[model samples]
Target chain A: MAEGTTDVPIAGYSAPRPRAHGSALHRMARRRSTTALLMCVPLFALLAGFVVYPFFYSIYLSTLNRDMTRFIGLFNYQYLLSSNTFHLVIFQSCLFAITAVFLKALIGFILAHVMHNITGPDQKLWRGVLLLPWVIPPALSTLGWWWMIEGSYSAVNWLLQQVGIHPIAFLSSTAWARFWIIMVNVWFGTPFFMIMYLATLKSVPDQLYEAAAIDGATGWQKIRFISFPMLKNIISITTLFSLIVTFANFDIVQILTAGAPANTTHVFATYAFQVGINSGNIPMGSAVSLFMFPILAVFAIFILRGVTRRTREAI
Target chain B: MSSATLAAGAAAPRRGRRPSIARERRWALWTSYIALAIFAVGFLIPPYFELVTSLKTSQEIGAGTDPWFTQHLFFGNYTSIIHNPQFQIFFLNSVKLTIVVVCVTMVISVLAAYALARMRFFGSQMFATGVFLTYLVPESLLFIPLFKELANLHLINNTWALAFVWPTLSVPFCTWILIGYFGSIPKELDEAAMIDGASHLQMLWKIFIPVAMPGIIAATIFAFTVCWGDFLYPLAFLFTSKQMVLTAGIVSTLIHGDVLDWGHIMAANILASAPPILIYAFLMDYYIAGLTAGATKG
Candidate 1:
């Protein structure tokens, strides 16, 4: 290591001089930092060109009319606001997100608690099993579910028949389609919540439980007062994350129903795709997609702020 | 043993908590087991049914054969797909695309992540936040304008066009993971090497990269999986069968206007899904830890 060569005043007072005039480590640091920066520039440029530019480009696109030459500022917005289909889609998107998020959180929390109560060996096995839905790629796994719910050869329908109930057309009927998609979304997502909650569960110190036990606290009491409070931040962040993703979900809705049954199941993304990419009406599609950004941005910002605040509090 | 057990039981309820607590524990245990069993079955049944269906013959499947039982083990479906040109082309295209995209993604991510994490510069925080937030931009919304951009660039039918595009989606998540991991490493290690007069490039290669292998692995897996499983991008970008990736190729060629070719379709789907599934099955701990690190460690 370099030390003590020439006397020189450093930041404030006189300090021992560095050992070597030009050190290999200093040269390495200089070279690597430059290399690292040089390496990063292209990626930053790529993101700027593709992601950042397209984001702003959509804003410009949203203002134009169908021909792409003429400007119709807010006309697409006016069309969206006035249309009955747009109104229905907005309502349905919320219904899909809110309902699925709530169910997933509740079920996930309970499942986590139950798993927490289980002993060694079994806990490890169950944890792996529970996370299977999340492990499989969403598109592929949802395709599997899609084939299962196919109207002609429906497995759930066959099961319903055995139970003396009429077979429901899960995908064909608008309401049933909405319900099943949300159910599948919940199923796919709850494991994420479970894992997060389980991790949080493990972090809650054993001493709190021991203290509660000393005070004659029941299991419910221990959980309600201790576990719930400890997990508030995670709960909020996870829920917010889930809400944005679910609201913007295109795959499940597209693959499951493709906005069929008179397009009753269409969320903003698929609906935008239908009007925009599928039909070549870029302006209208841009407007619809632009509408989704603000919602997601707001959710993301709020969640990030919450996370940072919690992090600050923790520190 | 019996006398000892009776004596111990007589002493156990002295505080009167044993019997009731035992009952409550039993109830909780039973309830937990039952709920877990129901959920386990619920999660298992659909995929299980799909597997069963995939193994059945087309005639058996169409004849309303009991999904639970197969008339005969038909490995012929799998064999026929292997012989099909379309299937083979799609498979090869997917492999080529996944490999190229992953390589490009890793390169961009490693360079960008190192800069964002270790470099002292203006706008690094803003850039990092922007990177993380980009992951939140679901591909659906972005694909519209991006599709037009490709059209303008004359890259719509290009298979390797994904080498340019896939990084946009992969880099943000991968870089964030890398930055988070790198940030957690102590600065003193770098400083000590600097004191010894080692070059920064050498230090990074010789020290930081090895120390952060898990992060690199996590990022690579994420990058590969996202590229491999991508549907919308491939669909929007590539139109011709020759240019198509496995996902779009299989759906287009097999489904063919809703006259579903179940045999070849199932075979192709199984083949397409096998890689990522195998990766996850073997490296679940890494995947889970990586995702958690991305999600909560941020």
Candidate 2:
């Protein structure tokens, strides 16, 4: 503590009395804290205006009638609960988020291992290629994907046509719509997982692997004993992060599928936009988007715990 | 002692496998290369197609031909999109909004992060945790409410609304990042600066900012990209074609009703997405560290 400054006065400098010193120090500390609080005003205002205020406002908005004239309590929620489209939204959101996140993690794990295995400069070359997909904005990249799968200009279907197979419409069928949505998401997200895993994988000590090698453990055995254990923290953390983002994904679904093929592919975001913005049913849209809240809150709790623990350890 | 147990547990079954480990390792390396090649092709195929489609004339794209090969390398799509004054506005708006938002986000985040990390104020711990939780709130979840709020303010169809709301998306994460970065500097440096009569702002500007340059750059890049790439807010709030930024503008203008312009759209998409991609390619380490550090600390 930088306390008792007045008690240790410098040469030829008169020290203040003990009581005066205490009061001065208290005033200084108070002033410092006041300045600190003032410094955070912009952040506090933004959070309150954008996040906190809107959070409660959405809760309020979700309860109103579609036109916002009449106060209807839980009507929108009840409507969504009863509606088949909302049911499909829930089912498809869960399926897409879980399946895509799982594939990303699995592929990321494998690629990270391979990247770690490469001893030469080729690692950089492969990494540059792999991470390219994530570098492009999701909206722009989804447009590229949409171009490839659109009618008549579909490169994939062209190749399939050559194989004596029928050229299928990729995004018009319900099953195919869900499949492609999850595919683009997994494609966009896997590089993030790979980069995260590869970073943590690099931190695992070489001696541990070499020691395991000398102990008669095979490549798979070394991974099971060493790499997996070391990577457990990051795997959970990155999976949780990716899970939240994937659950709330919009661009791919909006640009590529637009919740199409009979409203069979609606995630919360797209459905919210469909009802609220496109259809002009703001209350119902608010209700749709608010369905994403409970899961987000659940993830937030775990993310806070992990991130704070890491933050504390870093400090 | 632990190694002894581990070695004892594995030595019996692994004794004969040791001699073949070298051969097995070679095979694994070859398999890994093959796997990487597959992944590389899979990942590159989309962007490759984007490039291929952008280079060809409309007839080639309309012919339902193979998109893998670009026979005539034409630059008309790029030239047309660039020459169009409407696209020029969207591009300029994106650059302007992104620059302004990045500056604002950095100032707000760096100040708040420094304050929270350094000076103990009322509910600072709770405030710090609140920052992290705020970041987890996806923009998708709040777009509806924010839309209504912006409308009530009569800011709909106005680009100014985005200027006000865009930093909300970036500041929380950037603050969290700067807090993590600022937490690393030794306390004695600050203590010494304080003893020498440096104000909080001076210390932040003169000492901490210079020391934490990498973190600042990383956070700036993050803010810039988020603002540049934000599709939902602009899509909802900006109804006018002139009001939309690059991401939304490209869709609104390039796709007129049932007929979509593939060449110009891809070119615009390429142009719209180039900044962040180029930034990532150049600053991969800091970008990755800043991005993943939110969950998995660097």
Report clashes for each candidate as comma-separated counts.
Answer: 8, 0
State the TM-score for model 2.
0.94
Per-residue accuracy of model 2 over A264-300 as CA lDDT, tens digit each: 9999999999999999899999999998999988987
Which residue pairs does candidate 2 place in steric collision?
Answer: none
Tens-place lDDT digits, model 2, residues B1-298 = 3444545565757545455446666888899999999999889999988988899888887876777888889999999989988799889888888888888899899999999878867788799889988888899999999999998999999988988899989999999888878877777778678767788899999988998888888899889878998888888889777777998888766776366668888888898989998898788778777876666542
**Cα deviation of B138 in candidate 1 (Å)?**
1.4
**Weakest ten-residue segment in model 2 chain A by summed lDDT:** A5-14
**Which is the leading candidate under TM-score?**
2
Name the docking class for model 1.
Answer: acceptable
The reply for model 2, stretches above 4 Å from the true place, is A1-16, A312-315, B1-17, B20-27, B257-259, B296-298
lDDT of 1 at B263: 51
Score chain B of each candidate by TM-score.
0.88, 0.91
Q: Report model 1's interface C-alpha RMSD after superposition on the true interface residues.
A: 4.3
Worst 10 residues of 2 chain B by lDDT: B1-10
Cα-based lDDT at residue A45, candidate 2:
95
Across residues B33-87, which tens digit of lDDT does each residue of candidate 1 receive? 8888888888776566656777888888788656666777788778888897877
